[model samples]
Target: MNRQAQAVVLLLLGGAVLKASFTDLYLRYVKEGLRPFLIAAALVLVVAAVMTLWYDLRPAATAEPDEDHGHDHGHGHGTGGGHHEPRVGWLLILPVLGLLLIAPPALGSYAAGQAGTALASQQVSDYPPLPDGDPVRVAMLDYASRALFDKGQSIGDRRVVLTGFVAGGGPGGEPILARMILSCCAADGRPIKLGMAGNAPTGLAEDTWIEVTGRYSDRVAKDPVNEADIPYVTVESWREVPVPKQQYE
Candidate 1:
């Protein structure tokens, strides 16, 4: 393919990489090594396009194609055959079209209650105590995993902060619950549950986005709908926020 076509492919690849990086789907499906290559390929194509345009606009003379050499097809290069059409860099717009037309939804209620594969039992010696005086920022999964793995350990006395959506009300008409679901690997996911002890903020409902702040303490058991043995965090304060695009690491 011509340079323009190559650039277009690169742009599409790059856009896919960026989108995948932001979603749980990518982590669940894409391999690690290929992700970097896709990212780099997109950057190189973008840079080459800019440089080529600059070269054309400048007063510099253009060099003649090497007539003595046949198309370089070795070393993974493609042959530039006479029948090959000039690549239209504008075709890169396809990636933009994809972005506009296929906006992916965030991790939603569909996955909020889903559990990962079986839990891997591991040692907990590496987990440090919660910060003595201040709230500790931690991934929701780690908090839950630790709570389940080390049942006797107490964390409720310290502050912990988490972000997610407010799920619907629990049974017994208890206060509503806030949750974030993970679509991919459970290792990076695990819902951050907050038991709304106080008045839930206005406009809060099932799937309403929110951020909860509090010390990590044992709260009520997770809803029976949730099958896993994960633990819950007692929230000290809760506030609404924009829904995060991705819910996992």
Candidate 2:
């Protein structure tokens, strides 16, 4: 690749990063906390591109006659000043093009299906009491941990609200309320799901975001330590909701 091509690639990549950061699209792939770092990286790439263009377009000095070599053979393969540019640099454009044209959607039910629920073992601690509310809004993962590990002591008979995308087991089987948990980005994301009891909605489209109001059911693993199949929620009510801005928890 030529210097001009390198500069253009840098500029395009930098612009894509800046656009994703400014438009909040970065949240689809990465955590919101990475916004500042993304912005800084975009600035650095833009600066480097500008510098490359400046140096490339500057005036060049007149070439002197090659009196030392004494041979006039114009073979450009000589090792004196010639440098080979790697062809692999062209691959950089693939991501830029993908970002501009395809613009992949955030991970949803399909991804959740592939990465089945794996609840992290909760450490023994004085779990806090549920907040004061008729239907306390609690995360799906939080509800699962509380119900499975803490034996739903904090939940008691309190009604709670859990919000997540509907995944798997709905029509023939019971519906599963699932949320993606990400440590860094979508690539490292995994799903946490809670099985729903009672009357679940029928014919709900996959990945449809919904709010479910329910309480922990008595049906639980006899041995809590055994990898308990997803904890059950005795759903009392449910309704479709707009997909949240941040898809992952």
Candidate 3:
């Protein structure tokens, strides 16, 4: 395509990025902190594209008549003026179309199943007593770390609530609760899995968000894929819930 066509593509690309960054759609791919960067990059693309279009498509100054010939040949975009661009450049439009039309969802259970569960950090140590609540909320990572590294000493006997999506089950068919944690984007995301022991829910579809109240149980299982640790909890109750605004932690 020529400069004008390239400018149109560039404009569409900018619009796509701006749309994603301005809405919750961007969270599906990159961390929230990168929204500002996305917006900035989009603005730069838009400005550059507009400038290029203005320079390339604007009316050309009419040339003065030559002294000898006294003729005024028309001067505008000529048949041979088009730039030769690689066909591969056209592929960029595909992602732009997807972002503008159908925004993809955040990583979930099926993604979790595809990769081996990553163990919550092994630096487990004594945790301070949980704050006052009938059932204190505990992060999945914290629960896993304490359960695996500290042998549940920090978690103690307190009833804790955990939130994550249902990711099938363990090797023995025990129910599993999982959350994907990302350092930057979904490409770098990893799943944290916890096996449910008692009173666990059943038959929930993959990616079903849930909140479960359970006491920490001293149990651990190996991930069938890579033999990584999958912690355990003895669930007392559970209920389905809507997916959170921020699916990944």
Candidate 4:
């Protein structure tokens, strides 16, 4: 391929990658720390383009034209070029294509209890009663923060919306232990626990994406292992969904 063509192919490939959900992960994890890597990748394509142009501009190599084949060597797939033809870099495209085709599942049990853990020490007195019929949407992080900030207060029957990746469940799952991603910082993160309600989507597993809509109850739900200290939320509705590109964006 010529220099212009190579550049155009690379540019298109990059644009497709940018459109993918994995691109968000790339920005979060790789872009922040690897400015030089991006620069180097660009520079490599530039060099390939320049080489292609130079090859095209130079005198064409002449091979004997055959009567039947009619310029077999000269007018073959080879355009104005040196002895070499540009090779498609499939290896470079492989990973990018894989990510675009199939996004990996969200962080599972390994990072479940660890990431965005809900607060367990909220006090009973601070929570206000749930309004008559208002639908409240609150980020898991925010809810966790409120719990920590007003441990002395009660988070009464207020309708709240929580979003996060699923986590903290076994193969044979329980209604509780749903997970959510916090801000970039896991320490500040919070995952709300749902009390056994209606059957959750069975096919979905931990680290699956979901949105949980429910009213907060003042009653504290504790973990069985540590009955003394467990934070829980009584769930009214749980719905599985695609993981949003921006978990904390």
Candidate 5:
């Protein structure tokens, strides 16, 4: 790409990062803690772009005598000044265009289905009691970990709330609730799925966000792709919810 294209790419990339950082959109691609860094990095890109434009628009440097070649044929390094850049450099425009024109959804069921279930890396067999809420709001990963690892003692006799998007499961490809976990970005995202049983909503399309109030259950099923055990939730009530500001945990 020429210097003009390069500057535009830098400007566009910086603008995209600024846009994501200013809104909740960045949460879809990265963890919350990275927001400040993203802003800083974007500022740097913007500065670099401004500098490039300045240099490109400045008056041309005085042409030195073609001392080596006697005359300037300008055919490249025969006594050359021309340089070649790989055509692959143009591919950078694709991502710039994608970020500008496309508002991609957060990683949802399809991404979850493609990867193995990601649990907390730390191994903890003990868990504290659930806080005193009839249907305590529990994070999806926390519920999954406690359910599978601690044997559900922490959740004993309590209905808990889980917020996530719908994924297909159970009989006849019914909807199940799932929240994705992202360690870094969407590329590393995966889900902790809860197979819903009682009163689970039907006919929900994939990626429809929902809040489920459910009691813990002992039912478990092996993930078809990874063979990891997926725990169950005996859903008592559920309703569609707007997608959270931060889509991943």
Candidate 6:
């Protein structure tokens, strides 16, 4: 490929990254914390593209003549002619095509299915008392850890609210509520899940985001592991809700 083609690819890539960072489309693939870095990278790519353009557009006479032009001994290394661009450069268009034509969707049930249940952090064994509320809102991972490891001591008799996507097990199996937990970005994300008991509505589609109000049940794994069964929540009520702005915790 020529410098012009390379410049166009860079411009498209930079524009796509900048647009994704400026919009909600980026949130689907990465954590909110990565926005600034994405924007910076996009700016760098755009600047490099502009520099390429300037180099290509500057007056030819002002630029230094190719050293090979004066010495053409016909061994095919001369700048006067016979230089062939590498075909590998065309690979740059793949991402540009993906960004423009075959844009990918955010990670959802398909990804969660392949992931093991979220593990409780061993660093935190003790927790403060539950906050005051009719249905205390708790993160999915936090609730799972408390339920599985702490045996619901912190939860006590208080009701709790947890929000996540419906992963599986609504009809024949127990309903499972899950959220993606990201340490850095979606690529490193894993699913945190809690099993639901009582009257959880059935026929909910996979990846359907919802808010559930419930209390911890006695059912829990004695020795919790990544593959162990998820802890249970005796759901008191639930309702369909929009997906949160930050999809991961």
CA lDDT, candidate 4, residue 105 = 45
Native-to-model Cα distance after best TM-score fit, residue 159 in candidate 5, in Å: 1.9
Q: Give the per-residue lDDT of model 5 (tens digit) for 1-249.
A: 778778888898898889878988788789999899999999999999999999988996766576434445654446534354677877877867777678888888888777767753546779888888787999998898898887788888899999999987532356667888888888888888888888888888899999999899998777776777778889899898887888889
User: How much lDDT does each candidate structure score?
Assistant: 0.53, 0.79, 0.86, 0.51, 0.82, 0.78
Q: Poorest 10 consecutive residues of model 6 by lDDT? A: 220-229
> Which is better, 2 or 5, measured by lDDT?
5
RMSD of 2: 4.1
Off by over 4 Å in 1: 1-37, 41-96, 114-126, 152-156, 169-203, 219-226, 244-247
On TM-score, the leading prediction is: 3
Summed over model 4, clashes come to 13
Clashing pairs in 5: 76-80, 77-80
Looking at model 4, residue 69 earns an lDDT score of 71
**Model 4 stretches astray by more than 4 angstroms:** 1-13, 21-91, 108-133, 152-154, 163-166, 170-174, 177-179, 182-213, 217-230, 236-249
Preferred candidate (TM-score higher): 4 or 6:
6
Full-model lDDT, candidate 3: 0.86
Please give the ranking of all candidate structures by lDDT, highest first, separated by commas: 3, 5, 2, 6, 1, 4
lDDT per residue as tens, model 3, 99-141? 9889688998888888887783467376776778879998898
lDDT of 6 by residue, 1-249 (tens): 778778888998999889888988788778888899999999999999999988987887542356555434454564556444798988988876776666566677666767777674554659778899888899988888887777789999889999988876322354578888888877898888777788776788998988999998987542122445577799899999997877888
Cand. 6 Cα-lDDT: 0.78
* Model 1 root mean square deviation, Cα atoms: 8.3
- Lowest summed-lDDT stretch of 10 residues in model 4? 26-35
List the candidate 3 regions with Cα displacement exceeding 4 Å: 61-79, 124-129
lDDT of 2 by residue, 1-249 (tens): 888889989999998889898985888888888889999999999999999998988897655577434444554456366354798998999978876766677888887676646575555745799888899999877788888778899889999999998887422354578889888888998887777788666678889999999988865432122343567889899999998988888
Please give the distance, in angstroms, between residue 51's alpha carbon in candidate 3 and its true position after superposition: 1.6
Expressed as tens digits, the lDDT of each residue in 192-240 for candidate 1 is 4444544345555567666767654454454545433434566667777
Q: Number of clashing residue pairs in every model?
A: 5, 0, 0, 13, 2, 0
State residue 147's C-alpha deviation in candidate 4, in Å: 2.8
Output the better candidate (2/3) by lDDT: 3
lDDT of 4 by residue, 1-249 (tens): 444555555654554444542345444333233445655665665566566667757886765546537766547876555542346643555665765675654444445454333445544445454335556776564554444445414455566776765555422345344554444433343445443343344555666777777654434444543332334455678787776755541
